[model samples]
Target: MPSKMIVSAASALCLAATLLPAHAQVPTVRIPEAVADWYNAGDKFVQESQKQKVNERKAKNVILFIGDGMGVSTVTAARILEGQMKGKPGEENRLSFETFPNLALSKTYSADQQTSDSAPTMTAMVTGYKAREGQLSVNHTTARGECNADTIARNSVKTILEYAAEAGKATGVVSTARLTHATPAATYSHTSVRDWEADANMPTTSVAGYPCRNAPGAVKDIARQLIEVSPAVRSSLKVAIGGGRTYFLPSVKNGANFFDPEYPTTRGRRADGRDLTQEWVATRGPGAAYAWNKAQFDAINPETTTHLLGLFEPSHVQFEADKAADRAGEPTLTEMTTKALQMLEKERGGYFLHVEGGRIDHAHHNGNAKRALIETVEFSNAIRKAIEMTDPEETLIIVSADHSHTFTIAGYPARGNDILGISKGVPQRDGDGQISDVDSNGLPYTTLGYQNGPGYRAGGRPMLTDAITTQLDFLQEAAIPLGSETHAGEDVAIYAKGPKAHLVRGSMEQNWIFHVMREAFGFN
Candidate 1:
């Protein structure tokens, strides 16, 4: 392709990005080199498809990876960023799960709303039943924030993890978010409010409007529910890992909380004077152990340990970009997933494990595109690690997202341009009158930005140079200032491989995921 044509294509892309909706796909650069690379990619996919002639079979184990809020744009940007990190042209790169033989798009709308929250979307994925926003395992028949225990109990949908455990299979849940957060908690807990992760976050006294206020021992916070297994299931989980340690601990007498001088929000939320971690270790008996840091987590012996409960932070785990700066030194998502897999490997009846890249959503909500992208790369790495350890013949692996964000990758740049860098191809003129990277406003802009978020600039967008836009602490520019980026109402991608993976095909309802997993394991 001629340089003039390439510049024109780039300019068109820039114009479209500046004008189109945030959910619109990034325009492509279909130059000869790009076209050749795509052809090679297509050929590779064709070859892989030709070789995978395995028949449909039942899965002995199931692993579900949730990249919370990871939509198409996040994946594309992450792929490019990962490629750039490895010193290559990023556009051609593919994350590990992208190679999964079967792929589908998940319609992530909740039963009550088009733009759903994590509680409903994740509950739908695990339970095969659509739920209302903020309700954990309960069906949409239940109201959000309702404290009606009878209604909640009657309407609660049994999750695939519960079914797996009932059949005597080992079960586990891992995430970068708190263990009691929406995604992980939906696997086992039945609650009408996703925010009721700790006692402090719950209503202390019963009001006339609430249903369970007068009942004895009828309601428990999400954190308590995770530690207190129901008598109906096996409850012999091999792994329960993540953050939210503060939610499990009681506040100190002096009113000081779990003191993390580094992270200001690392304060205890449990006002009931209960230490759930200790209770968990005690309930699991001799072989079970509790870990609060990376050193303790690393010392765990999966062969002998019947259960491993790791809480590395007061709240959500640090973003992958800030992992090194965390003095607490929590385990990475990959580390947690591998450890859980090893422990579950000791089970004779197979296992059901849910691993979440939960921090991706948090970063997006904060309008910190760099952390979200970094979190995605780490999530991809964890998926790749799991693929390496599990066999396709017996284990079913899936990678999916609950919903998308208003996050976008716009602003045309030349091939091999830095994904996090300011818009360098916004069309400037050199001394020779040739177009360059600078924008029309004589300012640089980030290649990645959000539709609305905390990063919005009141006066026109600033010319953030690479030095600022590319930093780990940088927040991408937003179209509005809402303090947080809103979730997008578009469908998210789901990829699957291994036994019965072919079931994930075309466009499907989010709740259909539970049916696919059930079919994969022959759980029903």
Candidate 2:
């Protein structure tokens, strides 16, 4: 055969093999070197697909991972960024949860609003019901900031965490945001107003601009609910770790307020003369532990500690990019997750754990795509670690986002282009050796953009250079000017695996996630 004809035959064979379904057998023929890897990758997928069988056995444990504000665009960008960090072309990379066998799209709108907040979306996922925006686990019947305990009790729905504890299973909650923040708070706390995180927050205008004035004990702040009010939290919560430390302590008083353990200049924010951290230890009695810094957190022995509470910051934990600069070190999301799993592993009846990469939402709101993607990568790392630490057969894992940000990834850039940098079209350079792609103003624009955010320039769009847009603090360009970016009324992706994970298939309401979990555990 002619040399050219031999090459053509091999190329054809390679093309046919690469186009076959992942599980299909290929002809026994030599293939070109370039497409050899493609064949191997498909074969691996084939093996994995064959190994995956329907999991119908009741799950003994459950782990719900919420990546706050991680919309579909955020996931695609993060996947690319993570791959690029590993020195790859990036479009082929998948986050840990992306590999889940059962996938679905979750409608994130709340009962009262199309674009939703974390409180209601998370409440929907945990309580099997959509709720009003800004509310916690309670349903839509209760008004926002309703202070009457009787009304709240009637409207409050049981969360999966509560159901697990009632079934004699251990429970845990971990986040990079304040534990009292909407996502993790929905797992255990019930409140009409999410911002009422502490007694000090109750007097704000968002909550009627007055004190709770109901019967003295009719209403309690979110932090207090974690330590004293929530029966599931107080009795069975083996691990509670996150930020928002000041919310648990009282304001400065001769004998009431306590100085922050880590920050010299910061004091507790609570108006009530109560130290909830002390109360957590005292109420749980022996084997209970409290940690405020990385050193203290590292010292906790999960085997000996029956209950653990860790508040790592005065407010939200530092972003992953800035964590090292924290005066008193803070644990990463993966570290917190590892510790929570360790504490819950000993439970005989199994456990239910809620983990939130809460700062992802905050970074997006701030119009900081770099930090948001970094948080998402860290969140993926945490999920990877959880998969490694659990028995897939017994532990059902569900990963999702509460809602989406107005963030977007646009611009027709070539493959392997920097996801965070200005878009460079195919062939990158023009005939005159200038960059090929630019806006009407002849300025380069980022592949990343936001619908509205602080990144908006007051005059006109600024000329974007590679160096400027690639910086860690660079805010992606925005279309509309706003103090902060807003949430979008879009469907978010859901990934699930383990027992009964098949229930997660198809487009579903956000509240359906709770039912899938409930069925996984065979909960009544």
Candidate 3:
């Protein structure tokens, strides 16, 4: 039989099966043997549902995985791409966290905005309170650019990491983004403006800006908070690994600008003349070490290193698709997660670790779905590594996104279709099943698209080809033109497993995640 006829026949068979009663007599039909195979396979899934059980014991360790801008559609596309890479029909594949028993939908709005930014969304997750957009950990009552250290202290809410550290658990923060970026910084730093990452980024004269110098070190930038401001962070943050080398180092060293070790052309960002990386190592005394490149990171022995600070790049780390091209070489998200687990596990007391696949959002913003999906796949690999390294009984693993992107998956592509290629599927009603889908302008459209982004063409859509669509640098089509893609206001998914993971069930506000984590840790 022709392939198109087979697909139509299969569709008719599925429709008939749905319409007929269990005992209804039907005309004799020649069904493939795989029908019985699928029936038995599906029955096993029904049996597995009966085995679901809840773990009520308190958790000893907690690991939070945030896939920035990772939405349901992104997960679906990445799962298919992952399976396709493994030589299978992509629909049946699952990301690592997708296998978690308890999952929920998180409404990701902030106190002031519907489509929120990472700063407030992350603050919600870490502090159990939703703040206005651009604010970190501080409550909504505070001004957007408040530079007063005392005012921030008065309005600041404690994060779960701080609680864990205060209770004697080791703490760590890891990300593919700058360590001072909103998502990772929310775990340790509080600020009114997310952009104030370094002393140089702060304003000089405004009443609400750059007053930290006159406040006698009362208020500091996000990078300084990681090293000198936060009590829990400075004293107990055992592992800090990610990019943003310039955020910690001073622009001046020995009376001249201090150049980045990895990027010689770029100097450090701090104007205060303090190298926070040096401070990070000095304050921790004997067991502390700082690494600027892969060689140094590889040499640090997790067992003997009580404190670790690794900054691989001056800004955000390379996307998974571009990591090989990085000058100084960078660690994969999985490698960082493995090293973090190895180091945090050394303390007899349990630990709290925050790992962000921060570059997924960056890729999406650039309208590059290929890199975004690849980053998500790497994020999944890191989650799998964490699961393999920790005991599920004592480790509460929660995976979620701070917010979702406008990235979308559309059209009815065939089961084994290339996720990044033009949409092609068996014809159902009026169209030919064998041809790629076309827009009103007669241009072939890919299955993947964006609501608005750099991919938008002003006049008409471009004719897409397999070679063009499959390239790593290709940007998918967008409906509306914008320099950068904006985030979607829709809710994101939450996947959890281990002690008290049952609390993650049902729809909830994004901030509820913090409460669940706190409860799992047995904090009063």
Candidate 4:
């Protein structure tokens, strides 16, 4: 005898408890087929948009031009010098690459040291890996006389040019230095040493008498590499012009005759017993032609000629200032680039060409700012030509330096002052104040000059003695005992334009350049 209401509540509670397990394990609700279809469609659209974005990033062609040992200060000095020459402000003397939409800072250091040389730095840019100084596109080893037994033999990496060629893109390499020089060599050759010119497999005894001590291999030579080995390189090279005729000519040749200066002489003898000029002409095919002088280079018809080889000088081309002063007969860097572009553009697919103002680095080494500035301006002109010829949308252009020089500007002076001379604002009250009585060229009275480092002098000015200015003046001062201006351990600027150039941001390692180029060309 429980109460009737209590008994009913108990029964209801038991019934609810029975359904709790089922409710707790309930399944998720299912959407209708139409709603499911809508979601799928939206996801597809998003994926397609992403795909389009990636396609737009790949550039059809790329051109990278490096000014070895050029840094921010170098650019500033070059700009000021160009402006002064043109009677304009420094801001008005913008370089061709200055038009780029993206800029980045690049760390220039070797694997072994903070400061870098051209060889390893160029290798890093081209190969996407760091290398020790003086080493080329390979690893260093302590073993001696161990042919094919180094770490380089084990690591097989692909070059940007090789990848581009595999993708059916055209490529070319050009430089004011020997075409086989470090920067250009990084594109197609690989070895443990940068100086290796002959192939290891080649018979050393046969060519021992010739002065080709650094032959990495037979095809390693600039001429043979472009014409014989690496079919992709040869086929892609529609235009090959620079100033390394000695490497291409016979060793026995008495005199260097760049581009048949006079009528061709058969005095030189190659190992194959072939005339150097004939070998060059043969490589170009029957219709293709060659030139060696300014007049001959000018006379060539880019419209009709399919291939060209223009060697203006026997050794490295003269400095721009020397060339401008009529001390040498050679085409300007701008002229060479213009001609190369004109000839290369005729191909069905666009071309990848490299142009260098190599003499700028040479002048900087000698601490000759006047020569460096002139060479830099000449380099800028070549860049301008490339910009005008190629469309921005289809091409990606980069301007950068391999490293930095120690040269810098110092001293307190008013605007519009000549850098080569002493400061004009020195106080006249005390004997300590030295007036710069010299005019524009920085020639000082008496032999006394500013000290630059140890045993070095800035042949004229006696204004500032800081690290940067001391280095700059030391280069200018003829009496300085130093061999050359030294390179600095500092970051350099990278200017970029065209498709995917927006990716260049913040400071980055020098090897990242190769990655950028790879992604831009869809190599990965």
By lDDT, the best candidate is 3
TM-score, prediction 2: 0.91
**Candidate 2 Cα errors over 4 Å, as ranges:** 1-33, 36-47, 204-217, 230-232, 255-257, 428-436
Ranking by TM-score: 3, 2, 1, 4
Tens-digit per-residue lDDT, 493-524, candidate 2: 99999999989989999999999999999997
Q: How accurate is candidate 2 locally (lDDT)?
A: 0.88
Pitting candidate 2 against candidate 3, the one with the higher TM-score is 3
lDDT of 4 by residue, 354-388 (tens): 77677777777776676677777778888888899
TM-score of each: 0.88, 0.91, 0.92, 0.73
TM-score of model number 1: 0.88
Q: lDDT tens string, model 1, 1-524? A: 42222234456656756887776655333332432445555677788779886548888999999999999999999999999899877887899999888899999999998999999999999999998988898878775566766667888889999999888888999999999999999998999888888877877454545534224545688898888777534265779999998888876534555544336665566777677888988888799899988888999999889888999888888888888887868899999999999999878889999999999999999999889999999999999999999888899998999999998877677676789986655224222321335557776677788999999988887766778888888899888889879999999999999898888999999999999999988876
Model 4, TM vs. native = 0.73
- Clashes per candidate (backbone, < 3 Å): 1, 0, 1, 12
RMSD of 3: 5.7
- Give me the displacement of residue 333 in model 2, in angstroms: 0.5
Q: What's the distance in Å from true for residue 211, model 1?
A: 7.3
Model 4 bad stretches (over 4 Å): 1-56, 89-92, 139-156, 197-223, 253-277, 324-328, 425-455, 458-475, 478-481
